[model samples]
Target: MGIQYFSQVLIFGSFIGLLGWTITNQVGRTQLQVKSREDWLLDGTGLTIQGILIPLLQATLVYWLYQYLLPIQQGYLKLPLILAFVISFVVIDYLYYWNHRLLHTKLLWKVHQVHHTVTQMDVLGTSRNTLWTSLLIVYLWIHTLFLYLLADPTGYLLGVSLTSTLDLWRHSRLIIPANTKLYQFLSPWLILPQDHAWHHCCKIHNYNYGANLKIWDKLHGTYYKSKNMPSIIGIPSSLNLFQKLFFPFS
Candidate 1:
C-alpha cells in the first residue's frame, strides 16, 4: 500500500530469492547467453529517470487514490476475507495481462517499446516500461474497486505486494533448482525467470504476459508453453537516447 516497511522488505527479499533460485535452477541455465555490459543497462545507463520514477510515483498515486477515492466499507460481497483476497489477486492479474498485451499492440508500441528494447533480463527489467505504458493498466482502479467492495486495505496491499514481488523475481535471470521436486511444482504457476526470459526474447514468440499466474495467457491466445525452443530477446530495433527519453510522448 505504501513504501515497504522493514519487515515487509525482509519478507519480500526472501521471496525474491526464492523466485530467483527457482528460475536459476529450472529454466535460466538452458538459456545461458552472455550479455554485454551495454546490454546490462539498456546499452549503458539503463536505469532512466523515467524508469525509476514511474513505479514509485505511480504506486504512491494509485495507493493514495484507492485509499481515499474508493474507501473500503462501501459494500460487502459476502465472501470470506481469505476468499476475497484470493479473488482480488485473480482479478488484478487478469486486468494486468490484457493491459500488458495492449502495450504490445502496434499503436502503443512506440511507448512500450522502451522496455522491450533491453537486451538483458533481470529483476530490474520488470519496471522498464514507459510511465504512460505502465499507467495504462489502471491497477489502482482495480484495487480501489476491490478494496471498496470486498477487501480491507491491508489485504489489498498484501495482495498487490505479493504480486509485485512475484513480478520482480520472474523478470530476473535466475533459474529454479532442478534437484528439488518442490521447485518443479511451484515453477509452472509462479512465472519463474525462465518463463519471463522467454517473454523478453527476440521475436516475442511466447509473450507470456501474466505476472502472478500463467492462466491469463493460457486462456487467451497469447500463451507460449514450451521449454524446448528458445526465444530471441529484445526489440527489433534500438532507440537512441532522445527517443527513449521522449518515449511516453512518441
Candidate 2:
C-alpha cells in the first residue's frame, strides 16, 4: 500500500506539474494575477500538503478501517464493479456538493478561505487548501470506506483517479467559452472553469459547489453561469502565507 500510494503521488505530481505550466502559459487569466511570488510559493506548499500528504493520511485511515472495521476482503456488495464505481462516483459528487456549500457558511468559511486568497487561476491552485479542508471533507472518509467495502474495484479506482485528475482543469486558467456548442451541451452535467471561477472570483453569492459534476448545483440553486470572466479574483486577505497555512489554529 505504501508503494502504491507513493507511485500514485509521483504520477499525479508529474502530471499536475506539466499541466500547470501549460495552462499558465496558454490561458492563465493574467488580469487576476495579484499575488506575489512568495504567495505562489505558499500555494505550492499548500498543494503539497493537501494533494499529497492528505491523501496519504486518507490511505492510512482506509487501511486501518480495512484491517479492522471491514474484514471482508472480497467485497460484500455483489453488484458489478463498474456499477459500484458509477454509483460511488455520483454519490461522492453529491456529498461534495453539500460539503463545499457548507464550507462557505459563516463559521466554516474561514478554514476554506485560505485557498480563496490566491487571487488568480492556476491549475496547481486547485489543491491549494488548508489542512483542515480535506481533513473534514466527507468524501475523504466515505470514499475510503467505499474503497474497502467494494474491495478496491478497478472501475472505482479509475473513476476516482480520472475525475480527480480532471478537476485540475476547473482551477486552471483554461476556459471553454459558454457560448460554444460543446460547452452548452455539457453545461447541464459538467463544470468548466467558467462555472467554477464564479466561486473563487467572487466575495459572495458564489455558485457551483459540485467538485466533478454540476448536477447537484443544477438540481439545487447554487449554479451560476456567465460568459464574462471575473474582473477581480480572491477576497481581501492580510495574512501572510505562513499565517494562512496555520490560521484559525495558529
Model 2 residue 105 lDDT score: 88
| Model 1: per-residue Cα lDDT over 29-132, one tens digit each | 43324544434454224334333444465457755665686565456555665666576577778888888788778877678777776665655455565434
**C-alpha TM-scores of all predictions:** 0.71, 0.84
lDDT comparing candidate 1 with the true structure: 0.61
Candidate 1: 10-residue stretch with minimal lDDT? 42-51
User: Candidate 2 on 1-250: residue-level lDDT in tens?
Assistant: 6534554675587566746565457345353355577677766786787666767876796658666865756366656867876865777778888888888889888888887886776676777776566777886787676666674456666667656665777776667776799877877788787677788876543687878887788788888877666877778877776668777877
Q: Which candidate is the best by lDDT?
A: 2
Which 10 consecutive residues of model 2 have the lowest summed lDDT?
Answer: 26-35
Task: Name the runs in model 2 displaced over 4 angstroms.
Answer: 1-14, 17-35, 72-74
Error of 2 at 227 (Å): 2.5
Local error of candidate 1 at residue 55 (angstroms)? 6.8
